[model samples]
Target chain A: AQSVAQPEDQVNVAEGNPLTVKCTYSVSGNPYLFWYVQYPNRGLQFLLKYITGDNLVKGSYGFEAEFNKSQTSFHLKKPSALVSDSALYFCAVRALGGSSNTGKLIFGQGTTLQVKP
Target chain B: EAGVTQSPTHLIKTRGQQATLRCSPISGHTSVYWYQQALGLGLQFLLWYDEGEERNRGNFPPRFSGRQFPNYSSELNVNALELEDSALYLCASRMTGSHNEQFFGPGTRLTVL
Candidate 1:
């Protein structure tokens, strides 16, 4: 079984300030984690992923996520937030070496990021 | 490169009717995935197709089904739709050897009246 959790329904931060959105996962095997951003009425856009190695992975739009094995977390972060960064963020996971090799993702409920200028 | 594309950006169907949503994967990508994003429900995996075969399905009932054509494009058919079926139906595609980074399309907004 694989699952992802975005603990916060929303996160607010001011422009030029650092921002973080929390995500945690539970999977039977090594986890394949991903982050996506969705604008209003737009499809999800891939941000970054953590498959293996490099606990810290940088992604599009100056966003990054750190994979914590012991803590079971993959939190998205940005050094400086911009108003345009405001959007719905999603965390997803898939267990590697699972019975099914299909690329099926189990998504988190999603976190709405609000970057106020 | 053309990303995944879904047809009929918005669909309206009455209860007990059937809805068919289509998707065309990116060039060279062979895997297609379907998901439902209902209001407040987030994204629920619906189906997965690779190499023109149904690879896996979610916990949806038999009424929710789909197929992949030889070209790797796919279609999702929802039979006997209910009001609760109203949601954004998303289609994504990924390369076979990729690390499950599925690129998504704009999606088809399915509204069951």
Candidate 2:
């Protein structure tokens, strides 16, 4: 089985402050992690993914995430938050070794990040 | 180039009625995927079509079905729709053998009433 967990329901931050939204995963094999942000009534937009190499991964809209294998965590981070950065964030994981081509994504419950001005 | 596109941004249907959702993949993409985003639920994989064949499907019932066209566009048909079928149906496309990234469309919102 494969799954991702986002521990925070909502994280509020003042503009210009750094923000972090945590995510952890459980999978039979190594995990291929992803981050997507969804604004209200919109489809999710891909932010970044952690496939292999480089524990640190950068994504769109000035966001990044660090993958920690020992802790099975891939936490999303932003150096300085902006009001436009506020949205629903989701963490997803897929088994590194799985039925080839099934290629399904198991997603976390999602976290809402609100950056206030 | 155009991104993935889905039709009928919003649809309302009564219980037991059938519904069909359409999607046109990115110009050169060959793999089309369908996902269900119901309220309070994360995106759930519903179907995958590639090269005019059904590749893999999620744990959805047979009533949930779809097909890919020669042009790589696809259609998802829900037979005997139930109230629970109300969701934002998302269509995504990836080039063949893409290791990770899949581009998504705006998605079709289906309302059951």
The lDDT leader among the candidates is: 1
How does model 1 fare in lDDT?
Answer: 0.94
For each candidate, what is the lDDT? 0.94, 0.91
Candidate with top TM-score is 1
Report per-prediction Cα RMSD to one decimal.
0.9, 1.3
lDDT of 1 by residue, B1-113 (tens): 98899999999999999999999999999999999999978999999999999989998999999999999999999999999999999999999885759999999999999
Q: Compute the lDDT of residue B92 as modeled in candidate 2.
A: 88
Candidate 2 all-Cα RMSD: 1.3
Model 1 / residue A67 / CA error / Å = 0.4
lDDT of 2 by residue, B1-113 (tens): 98888999999999999999999999889989999999987789999899999988999999999999999999999999999999999998988764657778999999988
Query: After superposition, which runs of candidate 2 have C-alpha atoms over 4 Å from their true positions?
Result: A98-101
After superposition, the stretches of candidate 1 with alpha carbons farther than 4 Å from their true spots are: A100-102, B98-100
Candidate 1 lDDT by residue in tens digits, A14-45? 99999999999998878889999999998999
